[model samples]
Target chain A: MGIAYPIAKVKGESADRIYGVKGFPSAALVDASGRVIWSGHPSSVPRGEIEKALEGTAFLPRLEGKAYKKVDKLIVSREYGKAHAEVLKGLQKDSADETLQGAQVSIEALLEKMQGAANAAVEGQDFGVALDTYSQIEKLFKGHEAAKLAKADAKAVEKNPAAKDEIAAWKKMVKADETQFEGDFEKAGKLYAAIAKKYPETKSGERAQAFLSRHHM
Target chain B: MKLLGLALALGAVLSGPRAAKVEVGDLAPEIYGEWYLSDASSLEEVRGRVILLDFWRTW
Candidate 1:
């Protein structure tokens, strides 16, 4: 797929979790003002709808109440980072809104909850989950104590052989993809072959083997 | 102590309100992450441009 537009690889499906994207191949059109004018399956969205949104006319009705309700729902779901992003985006439009202000309070409460969950995951020896949760916190609330703790925990987890190998393989896979994307097939092939050789049982390694077999590299 | 903290955290999440699906007319959540090309950009940077956030995963 030759996509001319800029693309981003969201680290760890955080965007999916925040946007509540249950399935892949989803599309969202954001207006100049940072409002999501339309969202749905790519095939379902009308081509004209995107054009109209870009033109700043024929927009879906603004529903502040409904937006707040959605934020509240994220709070209930313990999607603190998503809720925080929602309120922060809302604040971008109107910093003085009382409802958004109130949502901020709830966001703080949720962060505390997140910290507790991460800590619990660590105590339970669920280093993977703990590492993921901590990374989320670090992304959402940079410079916070919880983020710091998460960083420290990640370092500790890396000391474990299993965790270390998993992380290394993941990083290598990402690097391989990036190299492939940059049109350096030779370099990508080397990385993929290394992965396939080192982590033969892993899914990524399997994918690398498949890629190599397909390209006969 | 960690177990107690986890319980308390779980309690807080359970006690909080549920979030509904965000749809059209909702403020777009800011996109933050490393860019595949060039320096990373945020929703704020492209505030006035038509942004088609095409989210994908490589798994």
Candidate 2:
């Protein structure tokens, strides 16, 4: 097992210059022959999976037709952009019930496993496995509080017809995240300010206020 | 006794970092409970695979 820290680089810099920035604890597994078999977030991917990834024996689960259908429906619905809030509300309710079930299990069990496995793989400097683990963490997060917030945000947008333009502007702001894109934060700040001005009581306005404060030039 | 110490050490390692985003090197936090795959298999069954779990609001 091996441990590797995450690298945070600007547009131009050596890949090795990761200083001060915090990294999530992720692990990777390596085989006897020094090959990566598995890797994932330090908290969730089981140690056993890391071993498998390191051994080149990791079995990627096949998504079934039903899951595909559900995802397709979600995508289609999101594109139309109506009823999204209600949809998110329903999904949040369902997810809440499922999350309650997970409480019975030991979260530490999975976290330890993934960490051990990642530790093994990082020894090989196999970043592909590292990236895969990050993806897994992204997936695992859907069942979390942030997912609920996302759902609520969607529902809120659905409730107010007048907020459509504001929501679109907010979406653009998110898409232009500094790490992801070189977005004009100044424009986003203006949009957020406008949304706040229009709907003083709305969460969108509140979020916009925060955005303006955080990304102020 | 050594095994117990190792177990404790692992426990500390497991609970170490908390980050908002799931980065490559960060620990994956337990967002919720048992996640079931489309195959009707419990998430526990695929403990070793990197999973891309996405939550979408269906309209």
Candidate 3:
């Protein structure tokens, strides 16, 4: 009953002031700007509205402030490469702007986090996670410092003699993720089991191990 | 005396932040309290997300 992100809970009276709630089980669907896009019981929120809001909604906010006003549009749309190039150009002209600096810092940190996790996966013999993580970073940060580093990391993983076999076994991991997200538990479970059986001693395998233990699949 | 105290408590609750009315399409007011079950410490961390603030109580 979980999604890709963590659910946050807050116990406070602040909920009372949000439109002065009228009854028990009041729910409000807010967009990124905190506007009440929908309000009512959870059941009443339209499914299409949720899907529409979810489009291009990544975990990170677009870099804030108007310091790089032109690039702001690009980042919001997830045109990272164009934004990256624009930010670089902005940084050259005015190096002191926090908003301009944010673009570099945020993406670099994200890259570092992924690259570090990939390295750990490789060390733990989870070649599937290692390759997938590196591949994503290599693609995601195409015009950033992380792209080169992820490529180098991918090459390092490829050097391992067991890398090919282990990575091949875990190839369906993405499909498992998609199925799980789609709520196709039976299919996802089978995919996970297949991956786990193929790459028995890795982190990717442990996904199936954990899923089965939790769901009794 | 007990009834007086209850009246005063209700008055205080009604006079608090809940005094403002919230309508659809209006910007939501700040929400905060003891947070749990999340990696993000503040709403700012989840800025890009569509947040559903649920108000519930244990029956």
As for lDDT, the candidate ahead, 1 or 2, is: 1
DockQ of each: 0.17, 0.03, 0.19
Predicted candidate 3 versus true structure: per-residue lDDT over A149-170, tens digit per residue:
8889788888878787676666
Ranking by lDDT: 3, 1, 2
Model 3: colliding residue pairs: A19-B22
lDDT of 3 at A123: 83
- Which pairs, if any, clash in model 1? A72-B18, A73-B18, A73-B19, A73-B20, A74-B19, A76-B17, A76-B18
Per-residue lDDT tens digits for candidate 1, residues A1-217, read 6534555545544455445565556677777545666777766766786666555421111225765887766654445556667778889999998888877775576577667877887675555556666776776565445567768777787787756555566567767865653335567779999999997765567767876775666
TM-score, each model? 0.38, 0.25, 0.52
Docking class of 3: incorrect
Backbone clash count for every predicted candidate, in the order shown? 7, 37, 1
Task: Kindly report the TM-score of the first chain in candidate 3.
Answer: 0.61
Q: Which is the winner by TM-score between candidate 2 and candidate 3?
A: 3
lDDT of 1 by residue, B1-59 (tens): 00000000010111223233334544455555655443335555554456666545554
> lDDT score, residue A116, model 3?
79
The C-alpha stretches of model 2 lying farther than 4 A from their native spots are A1-3, A8-183, A215-217, B1-59
